[model samples]
Target: MEGKPEDDGGDLTRRGFLGGTGAALVVAGVPTLGGVGVEEEGVSTQLLEAVPQTAIRVTVNGTEHRVEVEDRWTLNEFLRDHIGLTGSKIGCNRGECGACTVLLDGEPVYSCSTLAVWADGREIVTVEGLERGGDVSPLQQAFMDHNAAQCGFCTPGQLMTATALLDRIPQPTTGEVREAMVGNLCRCSNYNAIVEAVLAAAATSGSGGAQ
Candidate 1:
Protein backbone atom coordinates (compact mmCIF):
# COMPACT_ATOMS: atom_id res chain seq x y z
CA MET A 1 0.00 0.00 0.00
CA GLU A 2 1.35 3.44 -0.96
CA GLY A 3 0.21 5.17 2.21
CA LYS A 4 -2.91 3.25 3.13
CA PRO A 5 -6.34 4.93 3.00
CA GLU A 6 -6.81 7.98 5.28
CA ASP A 7 -9.21 7.15 8.14
CA ASP A 8 -12.08 9.69 8.12
CA GLY A 9 -13.35 8.45 11.49
CA GLY A 10 -12.12 4.87 12.08
CA ASP A 11 -11.18 1.77 9.97
CA LEU A 12 -14.82 1.77 8.69
CA THR A 13 -15.35 4.68 6.19
CA ARG A 14 -18.73 6.44 6.47
CA ARG A 15 -19.84 5.54 2.91
CA GLY A 16 -18.78 1.91 3.31
CA PHE A 17 -20.51 1.74 6.69
CA LEU A 18 -23.78 3.17 5.40
CA GLY A 19 -23.66 1.02 2.23
CA GLY A 20 -23.17 -2.16 4.22
CA THR A 21 -26.03 -1.28 6.58
CA GLY A 22 -28.37 -0.55 3.66
CA ALA A 23 -27.44 -3.87 2.02
CA ALA A 24 -28.12 -5.66 5.29
CA LEU A 25 -31.51 -3.99 5.55
CA VAL A 26 -32.36 -4.96 1.98
CA VAL A 27 -31.46 -8.56 2.70
CA ALA A 28 -33.60 -8.50 5.85
CA GLY A 29 -36.60 -7.25 3.82
CA VAL A 30 -36.91 -4.16 6.01
CA PRO A 31 -39.16 -1.42 4.70
CA THR A 32 -38.41 2.30 4.93
CA LEU A 33 -39.91 4.46 7.66
CA GLY A 34 -40.22 8.18 7.15
CA GLY A 35 -37.17 9.89 5.56
CA VAL A 36 -34.55 8.12 7.66
CA GLY A 37 -34.76 4.84 5.64
CA VAL A 38 -35.43 2.87 8.80
CA GLU A 39 -37.98 0.10 9.11
CA GLU A 40 -41.11 0.65 11.17
CA GLU A 41 -42.40 -1.86 13.70
CA GLY A 42 -45.70 -3.72 13.07
CA VAL A 43 -46.03 -2.08 9.64
CA SER A 44 -45.67 -4.49 6.80
CA THR A 45 -45.22 -2.62 3.51
CA GLN A 46 -45.86 -5.79 1.51
CA LEU A 47 -49.28 -6.29 3.12
CA LEU A 48 -50.20 -2.67 2.50
CA GLU A 49 -49.40 -3.09 -1.19
CA ALA A 50 -51.39 -6.33 -1.37
CA VAL A 51 -54.83 -4.88 -0.55
CA PRO A 52 -57.25 -6.23 -3.12
CA GLN A 53 -59.53 -4.42 -5.53
CA THR A 54 -61.92 -5.84 -8.07
CA ALA A 55 -63.61 -4.67 -11.26
CA ILE A 56 -67.39 -4.97 -11.41
CA ARG A 57 -70.03 -4.42 -14.05
CA VAL A 58 -73.46 -3.88 -12.48
CA THR A 59 -76.76 -2.44 -13.64
CA VAL A 60 -78.16 0.04 -11.11
CA ASN A 61 -81.35 2.04 -11.64
CA GLY A 62 -81.53 0.77 -15.19
CA THR A 63 -78.00 2.02 -15.99
CA GLU A 64 -75.00 -0.25 -16.45
CA HIS A 65 -71.67 0.65 -14.87
CA ARG A 66 -68.18 -0.78 -15.15
CA VAL A 67 -66.10 0.28 -12.15
CA GLU A 68 -63.24 -0.83 -9.94
CA VAL A 69 -64.01 -1.17 -6.25
CA GLU A 70 -62.13 -2.29 -3.17
CA ASP A 71 -62.80 -5.89 -2.22
CA ARG A 72 -63.74 -4.97 1.35
CA TRP A 73 -66.35 -2.44 0.30
CA THR A 74 -69.95 -3.33 1.13
CA LEU A 75 -72.79 -2.85 -1.31
CA ASN A 76 -74.15 -0.03 0.85
CA GLU A 77 -70.77 1.74 0.69
CA PHE A 78 -70.55 1.32 -3.05
CA LEU A 79 -74.10 2.56 -3.62
CA ARG A 80 -74.02 5.51 -1.24
CA ASP A 81 -70.37 6.57 -1.57
CA HIS A 82 -69.22 5.55 -5.03
CA ILE A 83 -72.49 5.84 -6.98
CA GLY A 84 -74.19 8.53 -4.80
CA LEU A 85 -77.36 6.59 -3.99
CA THR A 86 -78.02 7.81 -0.46
CA GLY A 87 -81.59 6.58 -0.13
CA SER A 88 -80.48 3.31 1.42
CA LYS A 89 -79.81 4.07 5.06
CA ILE A 90 -77.31 2.13 7.20
CA GLY A 91 -78.99 1.69 10.55
CA CYS A 92 -77.81 -1.55 12.16
CA ASN A 93 -75.19 -2.46 9.50
CA ARG A 94 -75.52 -6.05 10.66
CA GLY A 95 -78.53 -7.18 8.60
CA GLU A 96 -80.82 -6.51 11.54
CA CYS A 97 -82.37 -3.32 10.23
CA GLY A 98 -83.63 -3.47 6.70
CA ALA A 99 -83.13 0.26 6.29
CA CYS A 100 -80.33 -0.41 3.84
CA THR A 101 -82.58 -2.46 1.60
CA VAL A 102 -82.45 -2.50 -2.20
CA LEU A 103 -83.79 -4.72 -4.91
CA LEU A 104 -81.26 -7.18 -6.27
CA ASP A 105 -82.61 -8.80 -9.40
CA GLY A 106 -86.20 -8.28 -8.21
CA GLU A 107 -85.46 -9.56 -4.69
CA PRO A 108 -85.11 -7.34 -1.65
CA VAL A 109 -81.73 -7.50 0.10
CA TYR A 110 -79.95 -5.53 2.79
CA SER A 111 -77.21 -3.54 1.10
CA CYS A 112 -75.23 -3.35 4.32
CA SER A 113 -75.15 -7.14 4.55
CA THR A 114 -74.26 -7.52 0.87
CA LEU A 115 -70.88 -7.11 -0.80
CA ALA A 116 -70.18 -4.91 -3.80
CA VAL A 117 -68.33 -7.67 -5.64
CA TRP A 118 -71.32 -9.96 -5.17
CA ALA A 119 -73.47 -7.46 -7.06
CA ASP A 120 -71.27 -7.71 -10.13
CA GLY A 121 -73.24 -8.52 -13.28
CA ARG A 122 -76.44 -8.07 -11.26
CA GLU A 123 -79.32 -5.62 -11.36
CA ILE A 124 -79.95 -3.27 -8.44
CA VAL A 125 -83.03 -1.16 -7.80
CA THR A 126 -82.83 1.46 -5.09
CA VAL A 127 -85.62 3.63 -3.71
CA GLU A 128 -84.53 6.42 -6.05
CA GLY A 129 -85.16 4.11 -8.98
CA LEU A 130 -88.83 3.87 -8.00
CA GLU A 131 -89.50 7.19 -9.70
CA ARG A 132 -90.30 7.37 -13.39
CA GLY A 133 -90.11 10.56 -15.48
CA GLY A 134 -89.74 12.76 -12.37
CA ASP A 135 -92.94 11.36 -10.80
CA VAL A 136 -92.94 9.01 -7.84
CA SER A 137 -94.11 5.51 -8.59
CA PRO A 138 -97.60 4.34 -7.59
CA LEU A 139 -96.23 2.39 -4.61
CA GLN A 140 -94.56 5.52 -3.31
CA GLN A 141 -97.76 7.47 -3.77
CA ALA A 142 -99.66 4.86 -1.82
CA PHE A 143 -97.16 5.18 1.04
CA MET A 144 -97.78 8.91 1.21
CA ASP A 145 -101.52 8.46 0.96
CA HIS A 146 -101.52 5.86 3.75
CA ASN A 147 -99.05 7.79 5.93
CA ALA A 148 -96.76 4.78 6.07
CA ALA A 149 -93.58 6.79 6.59
CA GLN A 150 -93.37 8.28 10.08
CA CYS A 151 -89.63 9.06 10.36
CA GLY A 152 -89.17 7.81 6.80
CA PHE A 153 -86.05 5.86 7.78
CA CYS A 154 -87.47 2.42 7.03
CA THR A 155 -89.57 3.46 4.03
CA PRO A 156 -86.97 2.52 1.45
CA GLY A 157 -86.65 -1.00 2.79
CA GLN A 158 -90.40 -1.29 3.10
CA LEU A 159 -90.85 -0.11 -0.46
CA MET A 160 -88.26 -2.53 -1.82
CA THR A 161 -89.74 -5.47 0.06
CA ALA A 162 -93.23 -4.56 -1.14
CA THR A 163 -91.92 -4.23 -4.68
CA ALA A 164 -90.54 -7.78 -4.57
CA LEU A 165 -93.75 -9.14 -3.05
CA LEU A 166 -95.84 -7.49 -5.74
CA ASP A 167 -93.54 -8.81 -8.44
CA ARG A 168 -94.45 -12.35 -7.45
CA ILE A 169 -97.97 -11.80 -6.21
CA PRO A 170 -99.67 -8.85 -7.84
CA GLN A 171 -102.37 -9.01 -5.20
CA PRO A 172 -101.20 -9.99 -1.76
CA THR A 173 -103.52 -10.29 1.25
CA THR A 174 -102.92 -8.38 4.48
CA GLY A 175 -101.42 -11.52 6.10
CA GLU A 176 -99.17 -12.06 3.12
CA VAL A 177 -98.04 -8.42 3.15
CA ARG A 178 -97.21 -8.63 6.85
CA GLU A 179 -95.37 -11.94 6.37
CA ALA A 180 -93.41 -10.58 3.42
CA MET A 181 -92.42 -7.36 5.20
CA VAL A 182 -91.63 -9.07 8.52
CA GLY A 183 -87.90 -8.81 7.95
CA ASN A 184 -88.07 -5.01 7.62
CA LEU A 185 -88.41 -3.44 11.07
CA CYS A 186 -89.96 -0.05 11.63
CA ARG A 187 -88.91 1.56 14.89
CA CYS A 188 -91.66 4.14 14.59
CA SER A 189 -94.26 1.36 15.12
CA ASN A 190 -96.14 2.33 11.98
CA TYR A 191 -96.91 -1.22 10.95
CA ASN A 192 -100.63 -0.73 10.34
CA ALA A 193 -100.23 2.00 7.72
CA ILE A 194 -97.24 0.35 6.09
CA VAL A 195 -99.25 -2.80 5.48
CA GLU A 196 -102.14 -0.76 4.22
CA ALA A 197 -99.91 1.13 1.80
CA VAL A 198 -98.59 -2.06 0.23
CA LEU A 199 -102.08 -3.45 -0.20
CA ALA A 200 -103.31 -0.16 -1.64
CA ALA A 201 -100.42 -0.04 -4.08
CA ALA A 202 -101.05 -3.61 -5.13
CA ALA A 203 -104.74 -2.84 -5.69
CA THR A 204 -103.95 0.14 -7.95
CA SER A 205 -100.86 -1.08 -9.86
CA GLY A 206 -100.81 -4.64 -11.06
CA SER A 207 -97.04 -4.86 -10.60
CA GLY A 208 -96.58 -2.31 -7.76
CA GLY A 209 -94.24 -0.14 -9.88
CA ALA A 210 -91.96 -3.09 -10.49
CA GLN A 211 -92.08 -2.43 -14.23
Candidate 2:
Protein backbone atom coordinates (compact mmCIF):
# COMPACT_ATOMS: atom_id res chain seq x y z
CA MET A 1 0.00 0.00 0.00
CA GLU A 2 1.33 3.50 -0.94
CA GLY A 3 1.68 5.96 1.92
CA LYS A 4 1.23 9.80 1.96
CA PRO A 5 4.25 12.09 2.14
CA GLU A 6 5.06 13.25 5.67
CA ASP A 7 6.29 16.67 6.83
CA ASP A 8 9.98 17.21 7.82
CA GLY A 9 9.08 19.47 10.76
CA GLY A 10 9.08 22.61 8.62
CA ASP A 11 6.77 25.54 9.19
CA LEU A 12 5.20 24.80 5.79
CA THR A 13 2.73 21.97 6.10
CA ARG A 14 1.86 19.41 3.46
CA ARG A 15 -1.84 20.02 3.89
CA GLY A 16 -2.22 23.59 2.66
CA PHE A 17 -5.48 24.75 1.09
CA LEU A 18 -5.24 21.77 -1.28
CA GLY A 19 -9.01 21.68 -1.23
CA GLY A 20 -9.22 25.13 -2.85
CA THR A 21 -6.20 25.42 -5.17
CA GLY A 22 -8.31 26.58 -8.08
CA ALA A 23 -10.08 29.27 -6.06
CA ALA A 24 -6.86 30.41 -4.38
CA LEU A 25 -5.26 31.09 -7.76
CA VAL A 26 -7.40 34.23 -7.98
CA VAL A 27 -4.91 35.85 -5.64
CA ALA A 28 -2.00 37.54 -7.41
CA GLY A 29 1.60 36.21 -7.09
CA VAL A 30 0.31 33.01 -5.49
CA PRO A 31 1.65 30.78 -8.14
CA THR A 32 2.12 27.04 -7.88
CA LEU A 33 5.70 26.43 -9.00
CA GLY A 34 6.47 23.31 -11.03
CA GLY A 35 8.52 21.63 -8.25
CA VAL A 36 8.38 24.08 -5.30
CA GLY A 37 5.00 22.60 -4.34
CA VAL A 38 2.92 25.72 -4.06
CA GLU A 39 1.20 23.70 -6.78
CA GLU A 40 1.00 20.58 -4.64
CA GLU A 41 0.45 22.77 -1.58
CA GLY A 42 3.95 23.24 -0.14
CA VAL A 43 6.67 25.93 0.47
CA SER A 44 5.93 28.96 2.61
CA THR A 45 6.69 32.53 1.49
CA GLN A 46 9.39 32.73 4.20
CA LEU A 47 11.25 29.81 2.62
CA LEU A 48 11.46 31.54 -0.78
CA GLU A 49 14.85 32.51 -2.16
CA ALA A 50 16.23 35.96 -1.47
CA VAL A 51 14.97 38.69 -3.82
CA PRO A 52 17.56 39.62 -6.47
CA GLN A 53 19.03 43.10 -6.32
CA THR A 54 20.95 45.15 -8.85
CA ALA A 55 22.63 48.54 -9.03
CA ILE A 56 21.29 50.88 -11.70
CA ARG A 57 22.12 54.41 -12.76
CA VAL A 58 19.11 56.42 -13.86
CA THR A 59 18.14 60.02 -14.20
CA VAL A 60 15.09 61.36 -12.37
CA ASN A 61 13.64 64.76 -13.20
CA GLY A 62 17.12 66.09 -14.08
CA THR A 63 19.38 64.76 -11.37
CA GLU A 64 21.20 61.49 -11.91
CA HIS A 65 21.78 58.89 -9.23
CA ARG A 66 23.23 55.41 -8.91
CA VAL A 67 21.03 53.30 -6.66
CA GLU A 68 20.67 49.67 -5.66
CA VAL A 69 17.26 48.37 -6.65
CA GLU A 70 15.74 44.94 -6.34
CA ASP A 71 14.99 43.18 -9.59
CA ARG A 72 11.37 42.72 -8.56
CA TRP A 73 10.93 46.32 -7.46
CA THR A 74 8.64 48.27 -9.77
CA LEU A 75 9.44 51.74 -11.04
CA ASN A 76 6.68 53.03 -8.79
CA GLU A 77 8.34 51.41 -5.79
CA PHE A 78 11.77 52.78 -6.66
CA LEU A 79 10.34 56.26 -7.05
CA ARG A 80 8.02 56.34 -4.06
CA ASP A 81 9.85 54.15 -1.57
CA HIS A 82 13.52 54.52 -2.48
CA ILE A 83 13.83 58.03 -3.85
CA GLY A 84 10.97 59.65 -1.91
CA LEU A 85 8.95 60.77 -4.93
CA THR A 86 5.34 60.00 -4.05
CA GLY A 87 3.66 62.20 -6.60
CA SER A 88 2.84 59.09 -8.58
CA LYS A 89 -0.11 57.33 -6.97
CA ILE A 90 -0.63 53.59 -6.84
CA GLY A 91 -4.38 53.50 -7.29
CA CYS A 92 -4.68 49.97 -8.65
CA ASN A 93 -1.01 48.91 -8.39
CA ARG A 94 -1.62 47.44 -11.85
CA GLY A 95 -1.17 48.82 -15.35
CA GLU A 96 -4.91 49.28 -15.86
CA CYS A 97 -5.52 52.23 -13.52
CA GLY A 98 -2.79 54.51 -14.98
CA ALA A 99 -2.62 56.28 -11.61
CA CYS A 100 1.08 55.50 -11.38
CA THR A 101 1.87 57.02 -14.76
CA VAL A 102 5.25 58.64 -15.29
CA LEU A 103 7.22 59.74 -18.31
CA LEU A 104 9.97 57.25 -19.16
CA ASP A 105 12.22 58.58 -21.92
CA GLY A 106 9.65 61.16 -23.01
CA GLU A 107 6.85 58.60 -23.31
CA PRO A 108 4.25 57.92 -20.67
CA VAL A 109 4.56 54.54 -18.95
CA TYR A 110 2.75 52.73 -16.13
CA SER A 111 5.31 52.85 -13.32
CA CYS A 112 3.65 50.16 -11.24
CA SER A 113 4.09 47.69 -14.09
CA THR A 114 7.56 48.85 -15.18
CA LEU A 115 10.50 47.22 -13.42
CA ALA A 116 13.05 49.54 -11.84
CA VAL A 117 16.03 47.75 -13.44
CA TRP A 118 14.47 48.33 -16.85
CA ALA A 119 14.89 52.07 -16.28
CA ASP A 120 18.68 51.87 -16.20
CA GLY A 121 20.25 54.84 -17.99
CA ARG A 122 16.78 56.14 -18.85
CA GLU A 123 15.15 59.49 -18.15
CA ILE A 124 12.23 59.47 -15.76
CA VAL A 125 9.86 62.35 -15.17
CA THR A 126 7.37 62.13 -12.34
CA VAL A 127 4.51 64.47 -11.45
CA GLU A 128 6.96 66.23 -9.16
CA GLY A 129 9.10 66.90 -12.23
CA LEU A 130 6.43 69.18 -13.75
CA GLU A 131 7.59 72.20 -11.82
CA ARG A 132 10.36 74.49 -13.11
CA GLY A 133 12.05 77.26 -11.14
CA GLY A 134 9.59 76.57 -8.33
CA ASP A 135 6.57 77.27 -10.56
CA VAL A 136 3.93 74.89 -11.79
CA SER A 137 3.78 74.04 -15.48
CA PRO A 138 1.00 75.46 -17.62
CA LEU A 139 -0.67 72.05 -17.71
CA GLN A 140 -0.72 71.93 -13.92
CA GLN A 141 -2.08 75.44 -13.77
CA ALA A 142 -4.74 74.52 -16.31
CA PHE A 143 -5.74 71.58 -14.15
CA MET A 144 -6.15 73.90 -11.20
CA ASP A 145 -8.01 76.51 -13.21
CA HIS A 146 -10.41 73.93 -14.65
CA ASN A 147 -10.82 72.12 -11.32
CA ALA A 148 -9.57 68.95 -12.94
CA ALA A 149 -8.66 67.37 -9.60
CA GLN A 150 -11.41 66.38 -7.18
CA CYS A 151 -9.97 63.77 -4.85
CA GLY A 152 -6.54 64.35 -6.49
CA PHE A 153 -5.66 60.68 -6.25
CA CYS A 154 -5.46 60.32 -10.03
CA THR A 155 -4.28 63.82 -10.82
CA PRO A 156 -0.56 63.05 -10.87
CA GLY A 157 -1.00 60.23 -13.37
CA GLN A 158 -3.40 62.33 -15.41
CA LEU A 159 -0.89 65.17 -15.56
CA MET A 160 1.93 62.86 -16.67
CA THR A 161 -0.16 61.28 -19.45
CA ALA A 162 -1.40 64.65 -20.65
CA THR A 163 2.19 65.88 -20.70
CA ALA A 164 3.19 63.14 -23.09
CA LEU A 165 0.14 63.80 -25.27
CA LEU A 166 0.81 67.51 -25.58
CA ASP A 167 4.42 66.75 -26.38
CA ARG A 168 3.26 64.68 -29.35
CA ILE A 169 0.36 66.93 -30.31
CA PRO A 170 1.06 70.53 -29.44
CA GLN A 171 -2.41 71.62 -30.47
CA PRO A 172 -4.65 68.66 -29.84
CA THR A 173 -8.41 69.00 -30.26
CA THR A 174 -10.98 68.01 -27.65
CA GLY A 175 -11.41 64.63 -29.33
CA GLU A 176 -7.67 64.13 -29.51
CA VAL A 177 -7.30 64.93 -25.86
CA ARG A 178 -10.03 62.42 -24.99
CA GLU A 179 -8.43 59.71 -27.09
CA ALA A 180 -4.93 60.38 -25.77
CA MET A 181 -6.04 60.32 -22.15
CA VAL A 182 -8.17 57.19 -22.41
CA GLY A 183 -5.65 55.11 -20.43
CA ASN A 184 -5.69 57.33 -17.34
CA LEU A 185 -8.84 56.69 -15.30
CA CYS A 186 -10.39 59.19 -12.90
CA ARG A 187 -12.57 57.69 -10.18
CA CYS A 188 -14.32 61.01 -9.58
CA SER A 189 -15.77 60.97 -13.13
CA ASN A 190 -14.28 64.37 -13.88
CA TYR A 191 -13.42 63.63 -17.51
CA ASN A 192 -14.71 66.88 -18.92
CA ALA A 193 -12.59 69.12 -16.71
CA ILE A 194 -9.51 66.95 -17.22
CA VAL A 195 -9.90 67.07 -21.01
CA GLU A 196 -10.48 70.81 -20.96
CA ALA A 197 -7.39 71.32 -18.82
CA VAL A 198 -5.24 69.40 -21.29
CA LEU A 199 -6.58 71.44 -24.18
CA ALA A 200 -6.02 74.66 -22.33
CA ALA A 201 -2.47 73.66 -21.44
CA ALA A 202 -1.75 72.69 -25.04
CA ALA A 203 -2.83 76.14 -26.15
CA THR A 204 -0.34 77.68 -23.72
CA SER A 205 2.73 75.44 -24.08
CA GLY A 206 4.04 72.66 -26.23
CA SER A 207 5.73 70.74 -23.43
CA GLY A 208 4.43 70.30 -19.89
CA GLY A 209 7.79 71.34 -18.34
CA ALA A 210 9.16 67.86 -18.95
CA GLN A 211 12.79 67.48 -19.87
The candidate that wins on lDDT is 1
Q: Which lDDT tens digits does candidate 2 get at residues 101-207?
A: 99999999999998999999999999999999999999999999999999999999999999999888889889989998999999999999999898888888766
Model 1 residue runs over 4 Å out of place are: 1-47
Cα lDDT computed for each candidate against the true fold: 0.86, 0.85
lDDT for position 162 in model 1? 92
- What candidate 2 gets wrong by more than 4 Å, as runs, is 1-48
Instruction: Quote model 1's TM-score.
Output: 0.78
Weakest 10 consecutive residues of candidate 2 by summed lDDT: 30-39
lDDT of 1 by residue, 67-167 (tens): 98778889998998677787888889999979999999989999999899999999999998999999898899999999999999999989999989999
Question: What value of lDDT does candidate 1 attain over all alpha carbons?
Answer: 0.86
Lowest lDDT 10-residue stretch of candidate 1: 29-38
